[model samples]
Target: MGDWYSAEYPSSSLHSLQGYRVFISIAMILGDGLYNFVKVLGRTIFGLYNQIRDKNSRSVLPVGGRTSSPTDSLSYDDQRRTQLFLKDQIPIWVATVGYITIAIISTATLPHVFPPLKWYYIVVIYIFAPILAFCNAYGCGLTDFSLASTYGTLAIFDFKTGYMTLASPRSMFVSQIIGTTMGCVISPCVFWLFYKAFHDLGVPGSQYSAPYALVFRNMAILGVEGLSSLPKNCLTLCYVFFVGAVVINGIRDIVGKKWARFIPLPMAMAIPFYIGAYFTIDMCIGSLILFIWEKIDKAKADAFGPAVASGLICGDGIWTLPSSILALAGVNPPICLKFLSRKTNARVDAFLAS
Candidate 1:
């Protein structure tokens, strides 16, 4: 099933996701994506039709030139004007359009650098990444739990915004640009050093397995080819999920939010498919810690819960840098403890006794 797009790459070079669950997730993504595409297409066609119809029906105005508001943008429920040093802040619409422009350019040009990631695939990611990022950001704001990719999982704090705690978007944008500039220079140097040390990727028993690269590569392969290129029944599952997404949304609309409150979000529903069994345990433990803290002292938890959570997340990430250095030095933890399944534990015990 590997590399159905071309015969040049053997099975070893282009690894296909043959595992049942992983294959299903691929199907789900494909199916849901197709549904979204259809919806967008329909809406675009309808909008164009309305514009043509409106132009044909509307009467010509006199020289007096009296009309309604020129702008038809949706009004926000909470409209609060923000200022930076007595000047009005840049509008959200301006930022959004600017983002789209930059993203389009990046999508169009990125394939020149990474051939596996075709322009169309990049386009699709650009279209949906914002929605996914919004879901992750909103969920993090509510629960302090980030779901999805590493970037998605980041619960960035703004001192001004407070929980988010909110920062000025313009300032955030400027800071991000600076950070990205640094990362652009730093990341390649770090990777080159790792490459020099490791020699090659996908080395068996190598400390740096680079699973993220493998996952993205598989995605790119599927995107370049098609769902049919994947393992058998995956395409069928993709079809099922696509229809299922539409039907589920229809049901939610009919039932209404009060009744549909129990229904998990599309993003939340994907967690089981994407996450491992052990991740659920970690989530539960984290939830329990916060719950207990809140119960013990409501005031302190309200004030310090976010700070503590932020510290824990930052600490874990910062620890990795030192850990990687230690690992490269061939230093292992003195006591390496692990939890194993009952069957695996029994086998290890039996072997040790033998």
Candidate 2:
């Protein structure tokens, strides 16, 4: 990866890891997908084998109840839990027809709506998407991870969280729609408030850069230009690293998981490229706190860890609005605390004492 980047774009001055990041990220995603694919395929074959071997083994709802999710492999015996999760499902035909109608409308309107995406592309994506989506959901059920935006990789929404909290897709959808509608109405005002609070708007090197705009613009460019526009050797390196990642995943699987546990997950390691070290440092701090809490009281930590995490995530976000208000109001702290070298500290202490 380093060699390819240095050779192809040697003089390109950008982010510290910009040269290697994209190639490494793609490789990790491709490799992880391949690993999950093989595992799923093996399980499917085994399931088929069991079905053929014995008529009694044919899939049937247990006497107590059926599982809520198709991916709930281990929940078949948890009859009471399954029964509770089972809602009066929206009619299958209604779901099927509604989805088909929406898909058809979307496909028919694509040329007018989004000129870059031909109707055929949508068809192709949707055709393959179902298979991948199901696999992704199943993989997510097994592992609490969601690579939602990543195609050809394992991904899912939080099915466990949804079931635990909402218990109904209908309820979730209604709530989601309501929240989205409200956000659509309110977000512009919030954006304007921040605009007023922060002097530099849309300036390069500003911390408040509109990253989503850049992301969407880049995606649009990629869609319009397609693979032909990729950097000279980038496409070639993508192929190389993708294969390497798959090979590494296969090797890990072949080796006992106990020993292979030492190996870092490709998907996880790739995260630093997008999010950088700030969040990683914050996570480490949170983890240290959790570790201490766990030592202090394992039961409480086990029970409240998720709740505490959710609270912290939400609570951290909300302070921004109040800070923005303060900024807009021209409020300033009376005294500022500053860290300094020994000489600077002594001078400051002496000045304060005087």
Candidate 3:
């Protein structure tokens, strides 16, 4: 067993190690470092803007109340806190710059491991990064990160149409990934703001499902493989579905909110197809429960329904963290009930026999 493990597993283990390192470098180090840098920068700029605006407004204020004294208008503690926060960000800036420099040097030297930095790739990244970032930020601000998959799909479509013929698959993949990553990194400001707002209202950050990373991963796989790998029929169906979705959305916009209940949301219609029946059924059941509750006692439901729903959603999300940690540690807690196992196995055996 030891000999077999040593000989056969080494190559697989090495590959896994390499993949893990790459993932850590790209997703955790680069992505998170960039996010922190941008977040601090945004916070500093906004803080300065608010301070200046307040000072300017105070200068014109009529002598009265708290505004009578400039020092009283802004507390010393608050000023100290702001200064401390800004001072703390100095290291983050240094770290971000160092990480970027190292990443550039590594990419230049080891293109096979890191993303390539070709001239065309640079141009593509420059052109699409801001556009994707804006759309992603806007979408996340308005809704949740559920729209990330849609944004990613749109980005891929744009890239394929614009640069597929001009660049190699690897180049296109790297550029698109970088563009999308930039969008995700910069858009965290909106997400963080919403997260804090929800947190203040008793919702945990985990309750806010940001499944865009998973969507980005899936799309990246598809991008690498190319459309030619897909079946002709599947491609045709996708085109037809795209047209239908566009038409449905157009009608929804034209009709507006007056007939919103009557019109189906394109996302709502499409999500079931992608995620499948179990999640779709769960969502429908939840919605039905809410609808019935609202119908029964409008005022009571309006008052308490949100709190109850938030608790349930947040509970599930909170539990998922520990569950995930346990899973990573190879301690998967059994979810199945012992009482149901016999009946389930019997049914399965009977079906198989049939």
Candidate 4:
């Protein structure tokens, strides 16, 4: 349900969207598994395709191209062909080990295990380890062996605290300041623009029956719903708005179309299967191990890590647990049902008052 795309993209520029769509399409193809599959597949398929295409077209070689006679035949080095696999492959392995190990350790060592692990820790691990590993791999020539020792130590330390441990305090502060500015200022304005524009649409009565009504209503609701209620629809709304916006804008830019078709797809109409499945899997994994871990160490049950874990119970786990319950009953989350109930009730009451 995370945003896999964005809006405000240059909708009239197909050339620009080519790059963006490639990224978005690949993300659609591979989400969290992106690192493992996308990189490998791109290198393999494209490399092989080019090699065969070139081999077939090689009746004539370029002026300076090497031509081999019987005695001077080119010797293919099979080891060199495998060198891409050797290109800091160990560091990728080590960093991957670092991420998975840290996730497991963070999961295992966390004090309270009732709720679940926080995404923030996973975020920090992914954010830092890869950058450090890349630097060590290609930039500074640091050995992959050193990467695990250096970055792994930092990751473990960061898990104890909420922030990355290896980054300089000054850099962290600067980043925090910049991030705060964006969230507090820029994000609100972006939301407000969508709210007012969609609110202006003012779909009357049964017109809310269409797919666009879901988009229209949710945008208005998200821009106003209580913080408590917002999370319920936020995941689906966020996914639809972001992806639909990207697609609409991409097509508009590519096709040079007008803005009239920028309607949000219906949430009720789209398959809620993926999100239901995701939440189901998350709950199964969390429930299976969390209680066992909690029982094993009652002494450290409320430690700092566990405290953070408890906080996650308040966030993602909020809807996650309920979604699991509903899924168990063979029901998807009634996103459109809930929206219609609230919005329709309010409209009816307003008519009565008038």
| Top TM-score prediction, candidate number | 2
Off by over 4 Å in 4: 1-44, 48-90, 111-228, 231-236, 248-354
Candidate 2 stretches with Cα past 4 Å from truth are 1-20, 41-45, 57-83, 86-96, 131-157, 163-166, 192-199, 222-233, 251-261, 289-300, 326-354
TM-score of 4: 0.22
lDDT of 1: 0.59
lDDT of 1 by residue, 202-278 (tens): 65335676655555576677667875566555556656765676576557657998988666444344444555555
TM-score of candidate 2 versus the correct structure, residues matched by position: 0.66
Residue-pair clashes per prediction, in order, are 5, 0, 0, 2
TM-score, every prediction: 0.60, 0.66, 0.42, 0.22
lDDT of each: 0.59, 0.61, 0.49, 0.41
Runs in model 3 deviating more than 4 A are: 1-117, 130-143, 147-225, 300-307, 324-354
Which residue pairs does candidate 2 place in steric collision? none
lDDT of 4 by residue, 1-354 (tens): 124323342322211222232223222222212232345567899989988988967666456656555434422332332332233223457646867887767755653563555656655765665544443232112111112221111111121112212233334445656877767897687556545544433333322123233433443453466433332333454455446534643454455445533542122112112222443455446545656666887545423334544465457637855764564455754565332457668997899999
Which of the predicted structures, 2 or 3, would earn the higher lDDT when compared with the native?
Answer: 2
Model 2 lDDT tens row, 220-280: 5656678555445656666777777677777777787896877655555544444456545
Query: Which residue pairs of candidate 1 clash?
Result: 158-165, 161-165, 161-166, 162-165, 162-166
Clash number for candidate 2: 0
The prediction achieving the highest lDDT against the true structure is 2
Tell me the lDDT of model 4 at 132. Answer: 45
Across residues 1-354, which tens digit of lDDT does each residue of candidate 3 receive?
233123333221312222222222222222222343455578899989989888856555366554343445555644453444343232557646865675566545654555544644545554555544554443332222233444322334232212213343445456767988898986696556555554432222243444444435544665677745332244454445555655665576578899957876544544444444554676677778889998999877765665565566558558955865564455745674333357678998899999
TM-score winner between candidates 3 and 4: 3
